[model samples]
Target: MRAIKDEHRAARHRRRRLSLAVGIPVAMAAAAGLTYGTAFGVFGEDAQPRASAATAAGAAAGAASAADDVADGMADDVADGFASVNALGQNGTYGGRDGKTVTVKTLADLEKYATAADPYVIVVAATITMDPKGKEIKVASDKTIVGSGTSGQIVGGGFFLGQGVHNVILRNLTIRDSYAGTWNDKEHDFDAVQMDGAHHVWIDHNDLRHMADGLIDSRKDTTYLTVSWNKLSDNNKTFGIGWTENTTADITIHHNWLRETEQRNPSTDNVAHAHLYNNYLQDVAGTDITSSYGNYSRGNTKMVLENSYFEGLNNPVTKDSSAAVVQRGNVFVGTSGRNESGGTAFDPKSFYAYTLDKAADVPAKVKAGTGPRAATGVTAEAASSTLTVAKDGSGRYRTVQAAVDAVPANNSSRVVVSIAPGTYRETVKIPANKPHVTLQGTGGSRKDTVIVYDNAAGTPKPDGSGTYGTSGSATVAAEADDFQARNLTLSNDFDEKANQNLAGHQAVALRTAADKAFLDGVIVEGDQDTLLLDTAAKDKLGRAYIRDSYVVGNTDFIFGRATAVVDRSVITLKKRWDGTSQGYVTAPSTPADRKGFLITNTTVTGDVSARSFYLGRNWHAGGDATLDPQTTVRDSALSGAIRTTPWSDMGGFPWKDDRFAEYKNTGAGSGTASGDRPQLTDAQARNQEIADWLGNWNPTALNPA
Candidate 1:
């Protein structure tokens, strides 16, 4: 044993003996319903009186303090180090505080809310056994999963925080018993908590032990994390951080108890800043569990170890030659093998503020402080409701329409129906009663979440009543006021070539027939009549604002009578399903006294032949001569596919009879002001701006232009 010589060793042991003597009586009294203050008085004249049982019962269950004073400290503490840095416009890891709170006792309810689109504070109320052993529940961003006192337990399972997920907290739970009776678990990759490429996470005050592989596995460059006040024991590979070759992970591990662990307490590999302080590591010499190493710094990791107590068998502090380790103020008793510390590491104080406990008091403090505490009033209250839709049955609903249907009718506040990243082959509709419903996609990109159908205008209905008309053949129809869709794709996959035997090929992808509708960062794709922007009635005022989105189609794709504005968007003109390149971009049929369609600051391009596509055509609905159709394409980049004479007549309605014009448009397709291609004057173009088309409804306020 290469134990460090210290003159104060006897004094430290005496203090530990006194603490244990005093703590035993207090614990026995508390468990027996006796007076806690009376027993805690054994701490002599300097000790403060313990709190009453009623008051202590309301403290947070994860407080990393002694049982006598667990009520008033570290229960609601924010994370330190890189996790405290402000990123993505969010300051620190405040999980689910902005959303509603819910309690779940079953695995189904836990998985439903944990993988939801909206933020939630989920309280696990009971010991939920995993149906399939070692099933890892995938947790989404902006979530808080905490235990209700010490009753919450997850057996034979764990949680997975995937890539790009952020702002999550896991506290006050016991996740264990995933060990499949194998010391070297090669079959199962079961871990108590695992994260890959996730950031701004806090894992605190939990009891993690007997896992198949690692108690906590932070892999693939997971950063900005703090694992504090946890008790990790009874297994090989207690904790393993960093699997990536890149040294980008930043983590803080403090105030934890590593008892009877074989190795990796914890092994820090390829980490940017690994700060370990105020922890206790103990290993028995004759037990089956023997520590291979205590705190390991491997790869290009930079670690700072301070104020810790190590009572171990072998290799307490070790580092690779390529790694840096700065150790200070640590007491090593009865240790052997390499106790090496060299190279310069970063100062943690530069990133965040933290207090350190003395090394002599670490073993005593960590034993009493680590792991879950008693009950505390840290549970949040419910706010707005959020429903989740996932194709994998992990969320509350498997389909978007089911989540939408679950929303209460005439709801006063907003209800977000969050769609997980997957292809949903169905139609979804938001009725007029659901006004503040927002369909949000939880994905990295808009292309990840897809809602699609294959309905055509001439396709016969299943009821045999009649064929679905142009308006009825929509994949997603929003008939509610104040409706919004973001970060998703809506497509009508109607094959015109395959359906040649059918009559009409007008397949619509999306339709909005209400006021104050907004679409942002979305993809709408189809062939003909792809997007129908219409009103509930011919005389009603229906306005739609689409920004930073994509509209793809071939023939007369965007046609309606509503006052609509497509701003800062992309219009992709595609070939017909029969491999031809002849189609019209828009067929506007505006009312006589309404603003028709404004395509401003947009890019119109596609993979079609030059001069094969027309900018628009006049469409008088049902050949109604009283309707004055209008379309204005201005401040946009037109492609070579656009015809020089962009306007054309439809259904015996002359193009000149309607309002079809362009202003300040660039690109090869744009032409000079001729009688065939009307051009708006500088003064007239101002009246046809996006702001004028949207009226007092400021869609830009919700989603910036």
Candidate 2:
């Protein structure tokens, strides 16, 4: 019997490898262009492909038995992953399965049933768009929000699981298009789904995207949460975890397709046990958004990533200096930047039993199996014309700059340059002549596509023509009107530590100096003067809308002269290159008559020490006091890193003379109005709203209604 078992195991391995070799090309081809029907036929109905014939008759019989084992390994409706781990005396995440079933077609009906005390299975039966836009229906414990076949569509709003809520499930629904006019929506906390300190929840087989804020926000120590077989796309901040300092959250993320998103490809922060496997993260370049990173392990998180497929991501798998990440059996195609793993992560099998599909099969398997399954048949939208960029010869252009060069100098319509997942170490400049051009990332995740360079303000030109000034040191400079970048990273890895002797340390990751410019789901990083949001000229009116993106740096990081609104985004304040804790967040140099910068509905935080940083100091361009340098920080969360006196003087200019004020701000950094800390009154805040600054130009009109 032992001999027979050994023969069967060997036979199964050989057959699987053979099937992979023969079927992978077909799968890849199908993923590229085929419709849902054709893609589904390539794999048949089986979750795992059938094995080839064995050498002998006895071995053939054993191989047949092993095939049965493969079928049994696939997860079923009865909870799997971390949701299956019994905790708090509960068996698993059943989610009102045995409770009374109810059907709802309107917001009132859905809200009524969702907040009820009794357990109920709620079925959404129609396309219901929330009236108040971005409204979140508070859901109680022991509930299920499932779509009625393929008819259920929840638009412009979503559900909220509050603290201690448990035993809930959100499945088989299409929740999308909640985008308000402001990309950096600082006023609305809209999300497809959000849980605060919730547990025993499962989010599976749903399509979520284009929300005003995040697609999914699992914050405040949410544990016993399992996200599986879902499609998250067309947005910034796909999925986030852990807002609490305690590392108590346990999560399982698997078999999901995260595409066209910017960052937080499930950023697991301070998680005790984070088990991710068999997920497909594709960053489709040449779209409106690019991804920054995927599977980020932050704040002492212990993460285990396995058998996943990552395409065209900037940083596919990354961890903070204090985090532990263990990766295995993952396939990275066209990926670039940091694919790091360190420390021994916990064994996922000890907590729950789950099977992983082969990494090579993940893309096909996930695309075919995930998302809402219609009762009739699966369907997909047709592809649009796009210029492809891939370094591996799979795309039309070999380099990103080449694709940009191919675009018509003065194109009338939008020209999308889709970049495949890979590291592109070059500076990209979008000339002013090229308008309505989008630099998109076509990868499984945004982190799969990277556009990076290493040039500091002091770096000498190759032609020996002096230094590349702060304005010229940008990795990606967009000087065209209506320019957009999605789902990618623009990084200036200038090695500030290595070039400490250099006089000028400013390194610009991204500089946008055009009107109606937009950046979605992108990562712009450097050491000093990272994101420079300037106008076409000092007198030109340049309005840049940056949402669902990340800006990382220290001294005068987010400084510029443009009318910029950073909504629903994160401003990460890192220490100086020498590892010093002191720094400033912004150094606005706006013209006296125009608005400098509006950091609203955003979060200001990082790994820096408390009371070490200032909110901002006015920047008078060329010592010109005529510039008002106005900056309003409102309705945002500020970390303790900000000093008590968040404003300061600069270049012989008193910050009090400039326009710097805050309103309704929270966290340790926020304080009452004083001489140094200016606060906006309710009457004053009304004048400083997003609408007041963006007068006559509605940013929301750019997106689909």
Candidate 3:
């Protein structure tokens, strides 16, 4: 039997005892009411050994001195932070598939399909540069215009959704430098993408910038629309919804990165109900978002702001007396902004069945899924930017694996491998010799370029190992040093629903066992063990710089011994389809010396019920491993899926001995320190900075100019 420890060990037992004596009954009854199933161990007895009398008394004294009185507004803060809003509107069925396939390359070919009556999948083969500046192409109904490869652009022009235009899907295209004549010497006309009296439209994974007028304007009774994963930047007027009409406009703007723009990002005019969630707004000269300027004579507008991040902006939300704004789960950093409406605003809950999120955790959620990516080469010139992978043989290679195999061994300079907008179902790996390699996707965002595999930890491999271990089931594995990836999705679609009871169902989406790596605008999805940052070199170990990314999973999703810094990222815990008990988030097995996981300025979202998931636990593999797990989560937003007991024991390792701490965390899941969570002091938090953890390696220097 393992011997019981002292100091913090006794405190852990005390809290466990208190929780069992108090919180179990309530949680069990709540669980039953929620029909979440059993095996949650809410009332399980302590299986480990007990402490001595002296140790217990010392632990009690420590708890008394460390824990302060609970402040007021705790319940209100939880309510404000844990609310859920619909970003995709009432139903997930925004654009159902009922279209015929048709590929188009030039402007004439595109125009032919745009005016066609039947529903068509118009795939753009190359960049269509318009000689006539600001010429707008009118798109007809029932059209899906998707960029086929890296060369898809509408330079000096834009798209126009005229009257009666509906059910149009525009994705993975660039609309830039659109100058539709000049007015008052200010260059007026030309919206990057304009919609007039259109409905049921989906605009996703598109880059719209440098327009004379608004980047996008949906007005004149446009309803039932979803705009996601688009980057709007370097423009005067960003966007405006329901600008002209007093009619009810139902619009959802989520996962959009609005940067370096002026006002109207966007200004909501006569919108009936607008849901703005998980969006990143930065460096705006004017108003960020507004439900104000309302047609007060028409009716009151309702805007729900949830899980949004605002930085370097002023006057975030300005509401009219006739409009109502419910501000929840939003973060304002390094800027002066009004979160709540100054004038009369309607209740968001009254308009829809939704919950709120904590204002503090919004930054993490917003940056995780926002903006256009992998367009760095398209926007600027780079020597390393070359190579393309297209499924229809439009580019150099068709499969991502073939592109990796083509990389010369022991390459010195960085090589950018551009992937087209398509789903490649294959496992990919970068050998150790291939360094300074960048795998990029020309999809505007992660939703466009998808690389997937169906391998779980329980799945058998041809190798001697009976099953693919947790590390072996990854869809994309980068084993080389100085590896980088951006604007793409790596997913492991193992059927966890069918094999719920099977052991080792851990399906890893991305396994970065590299000495150094950087990930930006990336999406990694799986059910369990989604992201594995394994320690690579013995001297350097694994050091990763992950920013502006999204990771989704359930049990031990972000597990590894790597010293990783995850900044401005979104970590989402998806609820199991079978409705079983949700599992842990992080399982770090860091050694005694190294820094394990430092998740800062990130958002941790989930679909599970309140207080259902543990933040992290010390992973022991199989036996009592001497793994001193070190992790710190600060300045981030967490969903209600995290429980009050944020830290818990894993196997025989006591969580009290680990160096897991959080500071300045704002969200529903950020409970008081009296519970399982331990608050870090100012000095202790200073030791957890990126510079402090990474000795000489600077992540900011890695950014390509």
Candidate 4:
């Protein structure tokens, strides 16, 4: 068998001799309900415990000392000198989506989308000049800039993106200090957009790249805005992201992507109010977002990332702040570290690294103290939250993964663990054999807490093997049964800015092989394999119930042939930076006869226009993958951001009428219930294999009920 952990082996040797040094403590802990799976030896069984410690920061950990006390090798510092409560969530304090009713063509036209009276819609083109006097962007209390992606490109820094005007909107355009084909000797000190003292702004659907300074510089004043659906990349030889020192309140950077840049200072100086959500970030070659200077904080940043990808990056001080990168469901392939330590790497295109259970190359685990290698090790009870794990003096351990690893197999009692409010960066696994394991979060609200990671399928292994499926390509892999998660997010932040379009893209955020798994108020994110609910099991009725959640992805996101009922959730289509068709919805590779998927009461929204995305298509498994006719979408909102036809077609086969179906849904992406459509009536929607699939499980109440 694979070599046992050295220390555990030695402990067994001692236990055979009836030693009490290790055995006594272990037995006591186990009796106290701390069962270390596959019990270790009495002495010298485990290799030395890996390096872990406790400092004065917000987190503290405890463990029985064997080698000079747990304090010697353990360092209390969180990930890469991580500080606490630094940045926050998106939509900064605005309660809802900006419902502006106007067609904008320039920066001056942006006041229309605002909650104020004289709202303008700012339209930009191939190259619009910013008034050097800063008068062009001007002074507005409530203004909106909507670039008609087709008509305009705003150029030069005299007025860039922000300049101390409150309640403004910058949408749908490429805003950068254009080189004017040649370097403009006239471009001076003005930022592309400067938040001099701006408050309540929204920067959406704009491409801000290749600048001398920054895509955004918000340091002065209480700036509150939602920066969504914009592409912030390739700021090489320049600054990519900069949040200078100041009291910026409630800044939400959601749906906007950042990649292939340099000098990314996320938490530069002291800042607050940061909401980061689903956006593709690749090859980010700078400092992690969110600097650690001050703690002008509130509860915590609503840092959410769904259906985005983090491919590759060469810089390695951090893939990102282990404390700040609340990554979910993003791919991280061929990811490498700039440091002299450990980090994985992957090739961008060959996500298909393995086939039929054969072994593939694997990348090394990230070295400690670099990138996410740094972490916050806290026992379950360290913080206060909604869910709480019950532990005792015997069951003492530092991190969440450690506690789960300690659970005994075939235990008679169910074990439920609680996580407090904090962004924990650890790769956790619920073993296939460990049943009755439930991971719940403890936040005042479902959207306030999280557990995140950014491990791409193609990262490198320490032994030089391709780290895709070799290392389990998932940040959070659930192989156990009866597993349930609530009010928290599980993500694989293989953000491309950090991974550089290199994270072999097929990163699985939630890899499920469990039976009767329940996920509620949970968010799953990534670019390609965001929510991989895999029932590649021998059982036929492997079921998953996901509700009140949001799943965002660019590619075959909700893939895997698992039988699942997605209810009251969002299966969002991710948009591309170049304004291309981002991607489609479900690609269920269900074998015929198995109930595949049923999506109800959800919304399909994307950053691009309605013509850029499709509904359901052939899930790449050749003809075996029919569009299965099993999958269905009903009673939901389809945004104007989805393309209607060409639902599913592979290399040779056409899956138009095979599996995909829709019903009684209305919204921007909704169409007449006709041709090549299986739009269900309210009656049929309540009673089919779709409704009867998850018996007693109301997915329209969690359905496949």
Writing each residue's lDDT as its tens digit, candidate 3 over 153-224 gives: 778877888876776767667888875443212555778778888776777767888877878988777766
Backbone clash tally (model 4): 133
**Best to worst by lDDT, what's the order?**
1, 2, 3, 4
lDDT of 1 at 41: 21
Best by lDDT: 1
Clashing pairs in 1: 58-376, 59-376, 60-376
Candidate 4 at residue 371, lDDT?
16
Q: Candidates sorted by TM-score, descending order?
A: 1, 2, 3, 4
For 417-499, candidate 1 gives per-residue lDDT tens digits of: 76789999998899998887777776656677899999999999999999998889999999988888877789999988998
lDDT of 3 at 69: 12
| lDDT measured at residue 278 in model 3 versus the true structure, 0 to 100 | 72
Residue 503 CA displacement from its true place in model 4, Å = 7.3
> Using TM-score as the measure, which candidate wins?
1
Between candidates 1 and 4, the one scoring higher on lDDT is 1
Model 3 CA lDDT for position 427:
91
lDDT, model 3:
0.65
For candidate 4, write residues 237-261 as lDDT tens digits: 2222334433335454434445555
